[model samples]
Target: MTLSNDTLSELPADVARPGYDRAALTPGIVHIGCGNFHRAHQAVYLDDLFNLGEGHDWALMGAGVRPGDAKMRDAVLAQDGLYSVIELDPAAKSARVIGSMVGFAEVASGNAPLIAAMSQPSVRIVSLTVTEGGYYIDPKTGTFSPTHPDIQADAANPDHPETAFGAIIAALKARRASGVPPFTVMCCDNVPHNGHVTRDAVCGLAELSDPELSAWIKTNVAFPNSMVDRITPATGPRERALAQSFGIEDAAPVTCEPFRQWVMEDNFPAGRPALEKVGVTFTDAVDRFETMKIRILNGGHAIIAYAAGLRDIEYAHEAMADDQIRAYLDKIETTEILPIVPPVPDTDLNDYKQLILSRFSNPEVADTIRRLCHDGSNRQPKFIITSISDCLAQGRDCTGLILESALWCRYCYGTSETGAEIAPNDPNWDRLVAQSKLAKERPAAWLEMSEIYGDLAENAEVVAKFTALLNDVWARGSHSVIADYLTG
Candidate 1:
C-alpha cells in the first residue's frame, strides 16, 4: 500500500503511526528547506508532540525557494505531506509516519507562493534548515555578503525576490505593512551562532532596499539560535526499498540514525510549541552546546572524511573501524579540539566525545564519507578552521588541526590513493582541483587561497607547519603521514 492518510491503518502493526487528527491540525510554522535532516530532526519532534494530542495548531507548512524544491514539493504533496522516517540502529530498526506537515507551498519563480505562505498571520515561526552555506556569508571573513548578485537582485526587486532570505524579507514586509507581528525567524542549521547569522542575512538584505524596514526587523523579529543534530543520510534506492519491505511505498522516506538532539534558545516572542515536553532542550547556554558539538562531532567528521576518502573508505563506520583514521580522530579531539571547548552545562566533554565516536560507528546509518567531505570550502571555515583559530589564540597546540586542513587539500586533488577518480565533491571543486594541482608543486600555493584559509595562510607558524605536512603527504602516502603523526 502507498503511504498516505488513507493507508495509515494498513501499515504493519509494529510501525508507529500518528495518533492525532491530521485534518484538524492547522499551520503555525513554515519550515523552509524540507530536506532529510529537517524531516529526521525537527519534524520528528513535532510528530512526537502531536502523538500526545498537543500543539495541533503548530503544524508545519513546508516552503522552498530553490528550483530543486519544486521536485520536493511534488514528491511530498503527492503523499499529502506524509512521509516515513526510518530510524536505524545497531540493535533494531523502527519506522514512523510523521503527520506534522499539513501542506507545502507551490514553488514558483521569485518565490511568490512561498512568501504568501509565510506572510500568513498564523505562521508565528519561520524556521530554516537551508544548510550552512545557504546563508550568504563570506567564507573568509564570516560576514554577510550584501553585494552578492542574488542579494543585489533581491534588493533591486523587493516585491519579487529570488533567494530564501529575500523571500523572507518580502514576507516580513507584508506582515509589517498589514500591521501583523513578524514571525520568529528560527535557524536550525549547524553553524555556531546561527541565529545571529540568520539575522545578518535577513537584516543585511533588508538594509539594501529599505533602511527603515531593516531597523524594524532588527528590533522585532526573533532569530533564535539552535543546535540540531541527527545523522540523516540522503535517501536513495536502499531507503525506498526499506519502505517497500514494510509494505508501504514512500517516495521521500528519510533514513537516519536513531539519535537526535536539538538545543535551542528560548527567545520566541511570538510564542512557540511546548517542545520542551517533547525532549527539545530549551537552554540559555546553547552556545556551550553548539561549541561542543561543532568541534567534536562536525570537526571529527572532517578529520576522518578526507583521510578515509583518500584510502577509498566508503561508509563513515568503516572509516572509524580503520585504526589509524580512528586514532587520528581521537588524538585530534583529545589534544587539540576538546581542550579548547568550553564546559557545557551538566555535561562532561569526555563523555560527549565518546558518544560522538559511538554515533560515527553506527553501521546501520551508512553515512557516506563523500557527504562528510562534500563542502570543505564552507564547512572547514566553520567546523575545522574556527577550532584552529581558537587554539592559536589560547596558545594551544594546533598541529593536528593543521594536519586536518592538509588532508582536505589532498582530498581536493580528486584522485583516491587507489587511483580511483573521486569525481567533484565540493561546489568549488574545479577551483579546488586547480589549486590542488598547483599545491602539488608548491605547498604554499594551497594555503594562498585567502578566501578559504584567510589569515592562516599569512601566519608564518601555520604556513611552516602546513607546508611541511602537505609536502610529507605528497612525498609519503597519506597512511604513512598519519602513522608517523600517531607515533611521533
Candidate 2:
C-alpha cells in the first residue's frame, strides 16, 4: 500500500507505525532542509519520543527554503508527513514508518507562510540541517559573508526574505514584536562550532540593517551546537523497491546503517523535546564531542571520499575494502587528524576510530562515494582543511592531508584518472575544474584559491608537499601515490 495515514493500518503487521494519535499532536518545532538524513536521524529520535507518549506538543513541521525542496515537501505531504526509515545491517534489515513530523509548510508559495508558522507561540524551536555551504559562511574568515546576495536581499527587505536563515530572521522579528518567546535556533549540520556559526549568520545578517534587533537576538536567542552522524544514502530505485518488498510503497524512503549518534549542547531556553531520553547525549561541553567527531569521522570521510573517488571507486565500502585506502585512513587519523583532536569525555579515541572504520566498511548501507565527494568546495574548508590547519599550527606533519587535498584538486578536474566523465556536483564546479586543470602542470595552482586554501597555500612546508603530491598524482596515478606514501 502507498504509505499514508489512510494506508497505515494496511501496512504489514510486523512493520512499526506510530501508535499515538496523529490528530492529538501539535507543532512545536520547524525544521529546515527536510532531507533523508533529517528523516533517518532527528525525526527517528522524535518518533521514539512520541511513541513514549511524552512529546505530544513537540511534533515537527518540516520546512525548506530552496526551490528544489518543493519536491521534498510534495513527497512528505503526500504521505501525511510520515515516511519509512529502513535500517540496513549485514545480518538483518528492518523497515518502519516514523511519524514524528505532523506537518510541512507550503514550500512553493515561498517563506511568508513558513515565517508566519514559525512565529506562532506554539513553536519554540527552529532547527536546520542545511549543508555547511548553505549558511553563507566565509571559509577564510569563519564569519557570515556580509556580501552574500540572499543575505543582502534579506537585509534590504527583512519581511520578504529568501534564505532559510532569512526566514528565521523574519520569524524571530515577528515573535519579538508580539512578545512571544523566541525559538531556539538549533543547527544540525557537520560544520565545526555549528551553533556559533548559525548564530553568526543570523545575527550578523540581522545586524546589517537593524542593529537593535540584532542586539536583542544576541542577548535572547540560543543556538545550540550539535553533532549528528548517520550514513543515509540518497533515495533511489533500489531503496524504493526494498520498501515495496516490505509492503510499503513509500515515495521517499531513507536507507541507512543501523547506527546513529547525536551529541548536543543542553541550551534550550524555549524548551525542547526530550531527545536525550532516546540515547542523544546532552553535554555541557559540546566543543569536545564536536571536535572529536568532526576531525575523526567527518574529516576521515572526506579523506576516504576524495582518495577513493580519484580511482573511480563507487561505494564507500568498496573504497574501504582496498588495503591501501584502509591503511591510509588509519595512518592519517592516528598521526595527522587525531593528534589535534581534544579529549572527548567518555570517548576512547582508538575505539571510536574502530567504530567509524567499521561503519565505513558496511556494505549494506551502500553510501555513494559521489555523495561524499559532492561538496568538496565547502567540505574541504570545514572537514579537511581545518584539521590540516591545526596540524600545521601544532607542528605536526600534514603530508597525508596534503595528499588528500591534492586528490581533491585532482577529483575536481571533472575526470577520474580512469577517464570517467565526472558530472558537475559542486556550486564552484567551474572554478575547481579550471584550477585543477591548471594545477596539473603548475602543481601550485590549486593552492592559489585563497578562498579555499586560505594561508595553507603560503605555508612553505605544506605547499611543498602539496605541490609534490599533485605532481605525483598527475604522473604516478592515485594508487601509486598511496603505495609510495605507505612504503615511504
Candidate 3:
C-alpha cells in the first residue's frame, strides 16, 4: 500500500524500498537540526543499528531551532518519515532507507514542546548537527558570543528561551527541578573538540540564566566530542528523480558522495544507540581524526569554494576537474598543510589527501562550491587559520593558507570575477562586505577585527603574506594567483 503522488500517478519503481511495518521505536535520542548531513550520516548509523536489531529501542526525534526547518518538517512528515539516501560514487551507487526519526518539534513554533522533549527522561542523549556557525561561538576567540541577539534574548528570560544553548539550559533546569536524569549532550558538528564547545555554549547560557543550574549541569551532564564525515550535498531535482527511479517516495531524500566516516570519544554518560555495532569507531582521542577531516576535507572545500565562486563555477566536482585547482589543492594540502596535522593511528595523510581529491571529483554527487563557500567568516578560522598558525610556529611558510584566507575575504565582497553577484549568506555578510570594500583602501582594516583574526592581524609576517596575496589576487586574478602560489 503506497500513496500516489499528484504529479505522477504511478510512482517509479526505484523510489520504492522494502516495505516494513516497523513499530515506532522509543525515542532515546533527540537530534537537533535534522539537515541532510544528519539524515545521511548519524541518523543512517542509528537506522543501521536499528536494522541490526540492537538499537531498535533507541530512535531519534528531530528538532529544529530555526524557521527555515519548517519545510524539512513538512517534507519528512509527508513521506511517513521515510527518506532515501543515495550514495553516489564514480564507480557505483548504493541506496539506503533511514527510519530513525520518529517525530519533530518545531522550535520556532514555541520552545515549549522542544524543551518538553528534552525534559523527557526516555530521551537519554541529545545530538546536534547544527553546523559550526550555529553554535554562535566566535571562531577566533573560541568563546560563546554573549552579545549575540539570540543569546541576549535567551539571557533576559532564562525560563523562556530561543537559542539552542538557551533551550538546552532551560531543559536542563527543568531536569534539575523535576529529578529527571541529565541526558548526554553529544555534538556531531565539524568544529574541533565539538563537545567542549557545546558544553561552553550550554553552560555559558546557563551561567547567565541560573548559576545554580549551571553548576548542576557541569556536574551531571556529559558532552561527548564526535568527528563525523559524509560529503552530502543539498538534494534537488536530480536526487528527487533518482529517488523516484529507486521506487522510494522519500520527499526529503538525501544524497552524498560515496564516502562516510564517524569517529567519536566513547564518553556518553546517559546512554547511546549501539552505533559501534554499525561501523562507528569509538576511540579515546578523536582530535587526530577531527584534524584529518577539517584540514584535508574541509580545508580543501575552502580552497576551492572561493576560487570556484570567484570564477563563477558551480559544482565542486567541476572545480575539482580543473587541473589548476586540483594541483593547487594538492600543493596546499601535501606541502604546506598536512605537515601540521597530528598523526592518526594507521592512517597515511598522503593517501587520505588522494581520497579527498577522488571524492571531490565524484560528478555523480554534484556538490556545489557555493554551498561550501557559505558562511566563510565562520569557516575560515576552523579550516585555514590553524594550519597557518602551525606552519608559522614551525618556521614553515603559510603562503597558500594566507592566500586562501585572503580569497575568502575577497569572495565575501559579493562580486565574482565575472561580476555576478554572490548572494548574501553569512550572519555578518553585509558588514563583512562593506569591510571588504574598504579593505583595498586600507588592506589592514579588516584585520582590526580581533574577534576573527586575533593576534594573526598583528603578526608582521602574516600581515605581509596576506597583503602580498591580496594584491596578487586583486591584480592577477584567482587562477594566476593560485598558480603563482603553487609554483612559487
TM-score of each: 0.99, 0.98, 0.94
lDDT, candidate 1, 343-427, per-residue tens: 9999999999999999999999999999999999989988998999999999988988898888899899999888899999988
Off by over 4 Å in 2: 108-110
Better of 2 and 3 by lDDT: 2
Ranking by TM-score: 1, 2, 3
- Residue pair clashes in candidate 2: none
The best candidate by TM-score is 1
Q: Where does candidate 1 stray beyond 4 Å?
A: none
Can you write out model 3's per-residue Cα lDDT over 1-488, one digit (the tens) per residue? Answer: 23222322255544333233246477888888999999999887877777666766678888888888778987876765667788896787777666777788765644788899999989898889888888878766788777778888888987778777777887888887898888999998999889999998898878876788888889989998889999988888889877766666567888997678999988877877778888989998788999999998999999988888899999999998899988888889988888988999879999999999988988998998889998777887888887888898899977888888888878877899888999996878998999888776666776766777778888988887788888778888998888887778
Query: What Cα-based lDDT does every candidate model obtain?
Result: 0.92, 0.89, 0.82
Best by lDDT: 1
**lDDT tens string, model 2, 1-488?**
88888999989987989989988999999999999999999999999999998899999999988889889989989999889999999998899999999988878444998998899899999999998788888777877899988788888988778888888888999998888999999999988899999999999999988899899999999999998988899999999988888999888999999999999999999999988889999988789988888888888898899888878899999999999999999999988888788898988998999999999999998899999998888888878888888987888888899899999999988888889989997999998999988998888888988888898777888778988999988888999998887876
Give the range where candidate 2 is weakest over 10 consecutive residues by summed lDDT.
102-111
How many residue pairs clash in model 3? Answer: 10
Q: Could you tell me how far off, in angstroms, the CA of residue 132 lies in candidate 1 after the best superposition?
A: 0.7
What TM-score does candidate 2 reach? Answer: 0.98
